[model samples]
Target: METFTEWRTWERARADLAARSLGPDDLVVLDRAVDAALRWHGDQRRPTGAPYAEHLFEALEVMVRGAGVTDLDTLVAVLLHDVVEDTDATVSDVEAEFGPDAAELVDWVTKPPAGGQGRQAKRVAKTAYLRRLREAPPDAIRVKLADRVSNVQTLDRMPPDFQRRYYLETVTYVMPLIELLGDDTGGWFSGWYTSWRRRFGHLG
Candidate 1:
């Protein structure tokens, strides 16, 4: 089994991404966004007990390096994608630091407003969020696809019941968004989804 040290290597593997040819301003913004994310998510851990920043970094690496996305706004948004959801940060904070485009992409990818909604209502809200991604800028959806790929890769490490629900949710609420990302990302999503379904489809 991979230890935490081994898992942590994923962060270091992004050195190649950091070394990629980027414009001066783009590199500056990427560094600033990464620094901010590290500060905001300080010592935070995921439910799987991994450092939360690892997930964010992995998503950014995939979107920027793997997907060949060099847009500064999209890259910055990828870094701050979970800030509003997991930290005390606000969309305004991201906008003030990064730009309106970054803030808007983050907002577009964020889960919908949750009120006194029941389970079904929450599911409906989630579905709505996925559908909204269809119209979202391709950059935002690309980051979301990277996030989903990371989550799906680790689903087995979660509780069995939770894993089952996540699988169903991915197929129902998330797959369509992947489908909408179009060809380049669609291929990645399909390959991951197919592998996941082979392993867990029996649960559904």
Candidate 2:
């Protein structure tokens, strides 16, 4: 649990991007995506109280470092994945700025609105999202798998009840989606899921 500094996330993400050796054009696109996400998620915090951008960077890191993703559009989509869900940014805005493919990836990963309701509504929303992902493109599922990895990687920082429910959701909803990916990406997520389950499964 280190301090939530925006620079740290950029520093880490840049290092991973550099390792991939993206071309000049792709580098500029990734930078723009990062800038847009930072601007839109301004001053937002995660459940663990880290700056919201940290989660985005962590998700990208999981894809690059763990899953060996180097696709330019997928990486760009990773950067802007949450803007539509958490900020005022709309799907049309993402599509207009980042192009249809990247926007489509974000749209696939973004959960439907849960509204102001209890856990049941949120669970129903997530369940529906998972069903939709069953037929989503492999690349879209890759982003989602990486997102879940980043989320569950730090379960200790969350409350015991949250840990329990999230672990269940990951097993029930996410694992099946990972199966749909049918690539080594699913292996990466499964590794994380198994480790976290052993550590947190009893909390339920």
Candidate 3:
């Protein structure tokens, strides 16, 4: 059964947002973000072959429902976070459409290009990104945590090696980042990751 807390689909996400305390203007902004994400992602799919929008929705839902975030700009950034990294969209494009706060938040969470080829270089870039993420604004950190949660929550669908790599990265960097917060969102993620580790620790 689909619950208010689980929103991997637009229909569930929209319904959950409607039940929240957003004003009309907030809804408009979020709607534009959704439209932009879908349009820009255009047929993109996850490694498990789910529509890319599903990941976006899951992140946004984690922010709103799981983390109790309701700020319009933060939520908008959650929806559009991957747009700059994975699509032709740029930070300027995000800023022009969503304003500078959302732009900065999205840029803070977006992974920089790898400096060299192959897995080693990509690993370096990813490591650098996670370390840099430690200094991002609290909202950006939340966005990244929510993004990682959505990404790693379903690792079994991918190869075991990928699962192991992601688990180490999450524990080494992302989980520590959450620990530093010591806030409500941090508590939520602590519980979630602990349970997740119990289920997937063997793979790691």
Candidate 4:
């Protein structure tokens, strides 16, 4: 499913969210989450040199447009998923701003500085994070799966080593979570990623 994952701008994404059957409070929360993300991620760039908000927008679009997700808190958490991990923001800061539900979901998906110093430590930390995702609530897993879909959708743009490594990580840990969902939407995501993996046959 080549669903449109790029909103290109937050205004465009906001418009799409508005077009949905959301109420005033939903719009307000979404707007605040977008503004907060813009402020906290100011001047940051993705590895591909794109504006950082582009990634957040892509994740939002994946959940909303691609996965048919409409939960207000999940959408909000998707918007701010990386803030606590990448910025100086804390879970408490998120809780103060967006309340507990969003904060807890974000915390579940946030990768801590778990393993410590070296490259091996970093790998261990990431591995642990992925493995621990098994215990995440469904909405939190939805956030993560959408985030990963956005990241992996452009795999051809990354280096070969990164592609293989990420593909392995995705199939090994991430796809299983989708399988656990045991529903049609989850099957759709799993199929889409499986086709993505097939497209880049070298990942096999």
Go through the candidates in order and give each one's C-alpha lDDT: 0.75, 0.80, 0.86, 0.88
Prediction 1 TM-score vs. true: 0.84
**Please, what are the lDDT tens digits per residue for candidate 2 over residues 63-143?**
887777889889888888888988999999998988999999999888889865998888788788887888889899888
Sort all candidates by lDDT, best to worst: 4, 3, 2, 1
* Alpha-carbon lDDT of model 4: 0.88
Cα distance off (Å), candidate 2, residue 112: 1.5
lDDT tens digits, residue span 75-104, model 3: 999999999999999999999999999999
lDDT of 4 by residue, 40-111 (tens): 888999989999988999989988888888899999999999999999899999999999999999999999
Full ranking by TM-score: 4, 3, 2, 1
Q: Which candidate gets the maximum TM-score versus the true structure?
A: 4
- For 46-142, candidate 1 gives per-residue lDDT tens digits of 8888888778777766665555677788878888998887788889999999889999999988886655468888777777777778798777888
Candidate no. 3 TM-score: 0.94
Global lDDT for candidate 2?
0.80
Name the runs in model 1 displaced over 4 angstroms. Answer: 1-14, 117-121
Query: What are the runs in model 2 whose C-alpha is more than 4 Å off?
Result: 1-7, 115-119
Candidate 3 — which residues are off by over 4 angstroms? 1-5
